[model samples]
Target: MPTITLSVKDENFAGKVLQEVLIGFHSETVTIRDIIEARVLQEVEAYNQKQPQYFNGLVQPADAEKTVNGYQLRNKVVIDPEKQVYVALDAFQKNGFFVLVDTLQCSSLNDKVRLHADTRISFIKLTPLVGG
Candidate 1:
């Protein structure tokens, strides 16, 4: 079993550390999409287990708003995990965010790459200018 650290960051490069996940690799390579899906699924499971009334996901959960800490606590866990994953992948494809594997930028979901014990994966979310 190999483990990887998943992190989310903003434009200024500040990051939020996510949990490390143990993954099984058939060999020494896996697709980017596979990695993303695994991450999203793990997040969803954690959120579900915590049983938060609201779900704090890669993006804001539906019908929920951010709090002072920027997390939404909903009274009902009513969001689709699969849909959330799809939205994230779509966002990646549209440049809504970027993936950095071990400090190297990954450009495609289908791109295959090798994993290492110390590999740190970062999701850098880009924000758009209000006036632009």
Candidate 2:
């Protein structure tokens, strides 16, 4: 199976995830559920840490109720500073041979974060077929 690797500005966290998984952070062996969970948790933590005052009363609100770069955090998806980085498989699809390429060709999967060089992060959806 093809592997999809997620790289961040800092490699420290990347190394930690690899150590915990006992496999390449971007390997196909990782499950999609694990990847999404890690990403969600990391984002939530980062947001809360940056704005502790705002999150003091709200714990996993239905919606973040705030817009970050026009993307309203409806699901309370914030960055978690404590968990600086996360590594997991892309579970959007069931196929295990294909991989989600984080490049201009895959613009639909590319989010606004791709445009920002300051916060460089990307995720590839590994699938059974090369083209999903």
Candidate 3:
């Protein structure tokens, strides 16, 4: 299948998109696991190229501080895509965040998602309420 570019965003519970990027997928159909992996890889590659102090991806890195834009690593180091993918997958499984393919909510890591040229995917991180 021809590669398709889709819009990916990190959103908040208030429906505000904090960050956005366009990613190209080689296939139109992919599992949630695949999506996380690809997205992580792209984010890592971009960060690696720039060697930025903040990592703006699906999940935070080890010993990193969570900032408004992204995670601020303790040191300026190259992020491993595999580690990020692993953490992201675990986060999804543990309800740390949720994924939405267009308007459809994903239920499983193995769940299949259909992509279109205009499809938009959102990753919303779940923040715990301060007060009980």
Candidate 4:
């Protein structure tokens, strides 16, 4: 019924889980955790291109210690397979622009879905109200 897409700067990584994550929307409840897990798996696979086993379980401190795309991943990251929804918001202070990821609509575990590679994102607009 609904579709979910994950767009990444890395084309190869996004292609890995594009089908799986899109298929998760067939049901009524989509879990963002699963989607994130799939992405992480892709990242791990990319990191361990020589050995596939490096991405099997939770990423330990030693795993996070490595660098990826010039960025260092921290051990504080948690991979929870049981989590179902994700609400993410990003704001650009300089440009006054914001984006929100609606985990409820774009999850694969909930309805018929599709995945795409696009940089454009949609978000709801909210205005702060003054209250005493």
**Model 2 spans with C-alpha error above 4 angstroms:** 1-5, 8-28, 52-61, 66-132
Off by over 4 Å in 1: 1-27, 128-132
Report the Cα lDDT for candidate 4: 0.30
lDDT at position 2, candidate 3: 37
Give me the overall lDDT of model 3. Answer: 0.80
lDDT of 4 at 59: 29
Superior candidate under TM-score, 2 versus 3: 3
1-132 in candidate 2: lDDT tens per residue? Answer: 324435422123232221111112434433434434444454455556664433321112333443332223434444432332221123233332122223322232222222221222333323211110
User: lDDT per residue, candidate 4, 72-118, as tens digits?
Assistant: 33433433322211211111221122222333223233233233444
- Rank list by TM-score: 3, 1, 2, 4
Better of 1 and 3 by TM-score: 3
Top-lDDT candidate index = 3
Q: Is candidate 1 or candidate 2 better by TM-score?
A: 1
Candidate 1 per-residue C-alpha lDDT over 53-132 given as tens digits, one digit per residue, 9 for 90 to 100:
54444555565666645446445564567876787788778887787888788999999878766666676767421100
Comparing 1 and 4 by TM-score, which wins? 1
- The superposed Cα distance between candidate 3 and the true structure at residue 61, in angstroms, equals 0.8
- By TM-score, how accurate is candidate 1? 0.73
The root-mean-square deviation over C-alpha atoms between each candidate and the true structure, in angstroms, is 5.0, 13.6, 4.4, 11.9
